[model samples]
Target: MDNQKPSSGGTFKKFIIALVAIVILALGITGVVYYLRWFGPNVTDKQEYLYIHSEAGFNDVYQTIREQGIVKDTTTFLWAAHNMNYVGRVKPGKYRLKEGMSNRKLINMLASGAQEPVDLKFRGLRLKTQFAGYISKQIEPDSVAIISLLDSAKFVEQYGFTTENVYTMFMPNTYQMYWNTTSEQFFKRMYKEYENFWTPARKQLAAAINLTPIQVSILASVVDAEALHDDEMPTIAGLYLNRLKRGIKMEADPTVIFATGDFTIKRVLNKYLSTPSPYNTYRNTGLPPGPIMMPSVNAVKAVLNYKQHNYIYMCAKEDFSGYHNFATNVAEHMANAHRFQQALNERGIKK
Candidate 1:
């Protein structure tokens, strides 16, 4: 029953202790909240990939991230991004979205421009427009953008190619590139690959054949179109080389097909041959202004190492085995052509 009043200093010390405890508790709660917001799993389970387009601003990125519903929480991500100074550092690219990604990791990845590389592959493309369309699907630039660069004489000229011969610069192969590659960058990359492909040996082989690299591509395109089987590429190449040597027109059916712009033609009629296009090897001598299609590597090689042969005429084998019947004389070629025509007539492949 003895109660003594405490001193003012003791009461002040008690208040101070309580204040310190409250401050510590508040700090701990704040730290925990921030940790959960910034370091906790943010990505949803539904998305496996996220694509950010070129020149995307922070608002655009946030809109996409939220609209995709991959990020489990958006407000927290925005806060984290702001604190990390990532608001202005949005990098456009393709990114893999994981099932469980933290805001910090995602923000860091985007801010640092860590984009996935796309595997761009093209082969046997018929036209420059076709090439542009194929490339548009693999990267950031659209078909129109690619076509603009492909059609630009000035732009392609810097790469030592006219617009007509620019098709040769793009070799058929798989190339690894950033998804956000510009059209100009894509062309430069292709040009570099083209240079790499045409080594000193390949150049010497082209020289030996009295053909420029582009001319080789042109001839290879014809060879590729002529032979359905790879085994016969060298033979077809040799036949064309023989024709060139003899000053005879190539009279290639594929060139007629190219001239008519009718890929569905199973048989090239006399009318088709007289289409009067520059690509018509029947009417024009030497290589066409450009390749009719993107020639394969094997086709180009076939032209470089053409088979030695005296046969200058070839017709598709009547057996339909994708083999050709070779002839050293016009009479024999006519017989072969007659047999092939009979076979085609039996198959009902008119026109």
Candidate 2:
């Protein structure tokens, strides 16, 4: 009877051990299945995919990824990413995803920080327009917020520009930038691009012309506004340079129009001349402190490599086809200006 009792106790202990082993084996298999679903060969199937926006944070990223049917279980995906230290590694940008991506592969891709390039166009933009466009495309910040920030004197004072013209800082070009890039970073990158274009040789040429780089750009902006044809730029630049050397007031109509901030070309009445604005070349001489608009590289180059000439004044030819009449003296300029007025009358443009 004693032997039978001992045998029964041993059988009970063995049964308990077997049950625990079975439970552990079952759990191991389940864990393997879960792991394989997310990070195994099953991930290559094209039917299961996700598109992730680069700007999404970890939680948002996981949610978007799951919504696209890339991951069957959010908890498992989050767990895997966390365990692999990929939470901080995920790049902000558009990313193609597949199901069954291995934790290692996903983490590696995130760590690589791949970004989608967004084209930022700065062509023919005024400062306000450029700021609005940049904020809309890159950071999605409020236009008012950006304008207010740009308007702050303390913020823009470091650039060494006399005028608070933010538009002048940017060069008109299509730049590749990340979508979620900060405004400060965007400006920094643009400044870097500007520096790249303004090489030492260009700087020497600007110095030879007795103008700072910013001043050159400012003059270029004026030249850009005045000249309609590329071939006419050198002559226009030469004429302006001559006037500057002679300390003559640059009575440019464009300056008067810009000062008025009105697109209409109605007569530059005496009242318009009194308009208080820094852009008024007629009122405030010497490059108007800063650029009125972002000038193209060609315009800047034209100013730097201006042709030498004694031409002091120029007037748009009556044809308004962008050709100008160059004059070496005030009398000659007045005659050309009369011809321009006649042309304007013929076209019924009362300017």
Candidate 3:
């Protein structure tokens, strides 16, 4: 065989090819690692709402995330958060985590403060305690936090409300607000909403009725509680207005039930009516100091535009149809009351 010297050029070319291949492989592997750290699915299936408290620092948020096991790999998430500049910017909110969300997307959501809103709807909440408890479940602040403002005479006075009448500020509606809203912020927001609700026209209507906006709301609460059907609110409101003009006691059984602090009472008894409270309209000659419950819009409007009539007394229909029978005298009212009482007895609704 003829001996040929191995060409140096050929040998160099093979070496070059191997080196390039190795370099390309190394680069590909690095790219994959980077992708895993930055763009890969990091959120775990344990996806639940993450409530970042108001004014929470980065550490507190990170600790919450870590403790909750929100990410598949904590180390990778930490690296991604730092690299994406999400470490320093921590926003408080109610965040919902989706399964298989990339690390970058997760960091972006938290850093950008893109939070979910809570739906706060209040209707027939009879007590401040009930209202506070309802609010606490939707927001970060506890019930105690809300009650402190509701009961603070000085705080409520600044908003043109007394501690006893602060409930009038919040009417029945679905309010959209952030979960991180502080208690003070909630009160301010409700006051703003209240102000918006009482427009100049509505205020004029309230003035024409010989009542302030708050007094109207207080009367509306009684109307709201007494009338199960919205259509009857106007007639019921007129009856109460007649009583107001005649210097007669309201004798609102709902007010008496509210005064007793027992919402479970299906029928108001004499004992319950005798409960000692400023809210008890039975002994009182006018509307209670505050709203018995958060008034509905219909009820509030009913008071403002109450039908002109001589109906000074009203009673629930004995048929349990949630309607009330109107009367102009105590005799007719007592007859209506007797029938309702018999119905209540038949139904065994004794309190």
lDDT of each: 0.92, 0.73, 0.90
lDDT of 3 at 38: 84
Candidate with top lDDT is 1
Best prediction by TM-score: 3
Please provide TM-scores, in order, for all candidate models, with all chains considered together. 0.91, 0.72, 0.94
What does candidate 3's lDDT look like per residue over 1-351, in tens digits? 999999999999999999999999999999999999888888987858788887788788888888988888888888888888887888999999998888899989999999989898888888899899989999999999999989999899999899889899996899999999999999999999999999999999999979999999999999999998898899899889888888899999989888888778887777787788999998888889999988999999999998889998887899989988888887998999999999889988877
Model 2 quality (TM-score): 0.72
Regarding TM-score, does 2 or 3 come out ahead?
Answer: 3
Per residue, candidate 1 scores C-alpha lDDT tens digits across 166-257 of 99998888899999989989989999999999999999999998999999999999999998999999999999999998889998999999
lDDT of 2 by residue, 59-167 (tens): 7877766665555555665777887777876666544455556755665665576544667676655456555655665543456656665676765676544335555
Off by over 4 Å in 2: 1-56, 62-90, 94-112, 139-149, 162-166, 266-271
- lDDT, candidate 3, residue 18? 100
Higher lDDT: candidate 2 or 3? 3
Of candidates 2 and 1, the better by lDDT = 1
lDDT of 2: 0.73
Candidate 2 weakest lDDT stretch, 10 residues: 42-51
